[model samples]
Target: MIRTFFTAVLCGLLFVSCNQQQNTTSEQSATQATEANVYGASFDAENVISVTQLQDAVAATDSVSATVTAEIVESCQSKGCWMDVRLADNSTMKVTFRDYGFFLPVEDLKGKTVVFTGTAKREVISVDDQRHYAEDAGKSAEEIAAITEPREELRFVADGVKLQ
Candidate 1:
């Protein structure tokens, strides 16, 4: 009888502990969501690009310049560092600052118009890292791996980006 009682107590304790853990996780997620929403505000990227193109013409007259204006389709939430922008041509391009010099909040800028100057290159977003990114974005494990679509091109890095 004592052994059965002890086993039951242990099971009860484990259940309570698990419940507490789950509650803590839920609370933390809620807090994070609130914080993210508070910091997210709409900003147009296209207007930023128009200003950047004019500045680039004067600053980089001798250098190779590619100025693009596009709408940010997606971005990393952890750091507003990089984003995927959809061009008018219906193609997406990853834009990141040169040498990781600059960053902007993704939530505030996503779906906004942005103009940037940089060199672009076709590259592959690795499957492993892509899965990791999806996980970080709070996607389920199955959802992470299910994203197998290849991103066509990435702007290697940009020297200047104007966000409107």
Candidate 2:
């Protein structure tokens, strides 16, 4: 009787341990899958921009189309949901998805080429937010303070962005 009871307990413990390990592995796999699918379906920059240009196209049918491609200069710390890309003109443009949807790792986007379709509007960021952004961009205290006052600048809310 003693031998049987000991054997039963040992088998039960092993089964529970194995079950726990399986559950952990499954959870990790699910997390990775979720991450992989977070960025929405991959799209070409041109297609994304085409939809954004519809309004402008309608306004002036003969107007020449404008498209922009730039390197990601900065990204949101929380994720790649928002980023600022440096244009060929040496201007930085804020790029966020339409309706504030979806996110990506901002750090992963730095130095990447991103093509986007959107309208660029001039906006003034709050001083505090400006300081924070400057710091995040690796600016020194003196550099940050010099431009602490709100400044108007162009910002782009992209309908779609393709990173290369």
Candidate 3:
């Protein structure tokens, strides 16, 4: 009788343990889903082109809409309103959110690879705008003050962005 009782208890414990593990797995799945999607718009990685391709397209014309994949060189430290991504030729392109629709997390984005769908344009950013961006990035006063010339750069306005 004792042996039967012990076996029943062991089976019961195993069942309970298995049930708990299933719950934990479901919870983890939910958490992963939450983390994977950001800024509402879905990120499609299938059509993403390298920064080099984007640069070539932009150079061929003034602007083009494209899906691009690149490494985040830096992001707006204050609000994540903008980001800079590295290009294949060791250059960087500035990326902005589309229509002020969404923002990225302002922390821990540097050096991360991300895919973005957006329009890329070649723009001349004025010195005042450069200074403003520097301030937003929390640059030192001297760094902010060092801005003197306008920057001719490739700028992207992204409708959607996803960290990879």
Best by lDDT: 3
Name the regions of candidate 1 deviating beyond 4 angstroms: 1-65, 89-91, 135-138, 148-156
Q: Judging by TM-score against the true structure, name the best candidate.
A: 3
Question: What TM-score would every model get versus the actual structure?
Answer: 0.52, 0.53, 0.77
Worst 10 residues of 2 by lDDT: 47-56
Q: Global lDDT of each model? A: 0.61, 0.64, 0.87
Please give the lDDT score at residue 89 for candidate 1.
57
Q: Give the Cα-based TM-score of candidate 3 against the true structure.
A: 0.77
Decide which is better by lDDT, 1 or 2.
2
Quantify how close model 3 is to the true structure by its C-alpha RMSD in Å: 8.5
Model 3 lDDT, full chain set: 0.87
lDDT of 2 by residue, 1-164 (tens): 99999999999999999999999999978876754533543444453343234334434543233345677877877545578877545667666676777666546567877666656665678888778776766677899888747876556666555565
lDDT of 3 at 60: 93
C-alpha lDDT (0 to 100) for residue 20 of candidate 2: 100
Output the lDDT of residue 39, model 3: 60
lDDT of 3 by residue, 1-164 (tens): 99999999999999999999999999978966876755636765687799999988989997899988899988998888999899888788889898778888879688898989989999999999999988988899999989999989889999988887
